[model samples]
Target: MLKKDKERNDAFLAIGNIANSVKSAIAPYLDGVLIYVREGLSVQSRKRGSVNPVFDCISRLAVAVGQTLSKYMEALLDPIFACDLTPKLTQALVDMGFYIPPVKPTIQERLLDMLSMVLCGEPFKPLGAPQPNTLNSVPIIPKDAKDP
Candidate 1:
């Protein structure tokens, strides 16, 4: 059991630090991906001597997807950084597949699971460990609190 307050704090802090790093890395990396894909397609379009709707559509889609994902990561990381460690750990455990779901997880759920796996070690199987019914089901806390 999570007996020591210090241990809990340390675990939470370490995970928060990981979340912050993820937040820092995601934006630029996403932007770079968009830029690289767009530029490569642009060069190809130029080589072809005519506008390619396929390239244009793909570039637009990349920008839209990047922006959406960036916003979602920011949303996820905010609570991970500031909320009580109890909830964070609970959610992280669920994300890391410590628990089995009654239903299939959504795409966002899968992404969070991957993120949790990266931050935490391997997941405990539901049969091996007591499982939570849901993963990261905590309410979205708005960004009213100061950054740590």
Candidate 2:
């Protein structure tokens, strides 16, 4: 019985770890999807005259796709958390103005509050090795110099 309990615990731990990694990895992609949906809807709304039915249809289609993906991501995360904590975490996100409702919005408001601008304290600096300047670092051989 003890060994069986240990195996069950191990299974739960593995599942939790997988869920955490997936949540971290997919977050950026979901943000990109949200951005795409927002931009597509914005363009559709700016048409001068009666909107083309096809364009509007495509815009709605995009929004639905984005929403479906986002909800799936959330569903994945939900199982990782304790049942009681799930609603609390969601409410916290809502309080921070980061929650997007499941309801579809009019095209004009679809893009609103979807994109957030992040201000970095410092610019990113690449950690690559300093490249040697071939022209300056290498000594030039005279035209008459024989090959070594």
Q: Against the true structure, whose lDDT is highest?
A: 1
With a 3 Å backbone cut-off (N, CA, C), the pairs that clash in candidate 1 are none
lDDT of 2 by residue, 1-148 (tens): 1124344334333433443445444444555443432332243332322212212322232233434444533332222122222343333233222223443232113122222112343333335947657888888878866766
lDDT per model, in order? 0.37, 0.33
Q: Residue by residue across 1-148, what tens digits does model 1's lDDT show? A: 1234455334334433443445434444454443432333343433543223222322233232333443333323333323223432344424422222221144245445555666675532444665565657666778866775
| Residue 13 shift from truth in candidate 1, angstroms | 39
Model 2: lDDT to the true structure: 0.33
Q: What's the C-alpha lDDT at position 112 in model 1?
A: 53
For each candidate in turn, the TM-score is: 0.18, 0.18
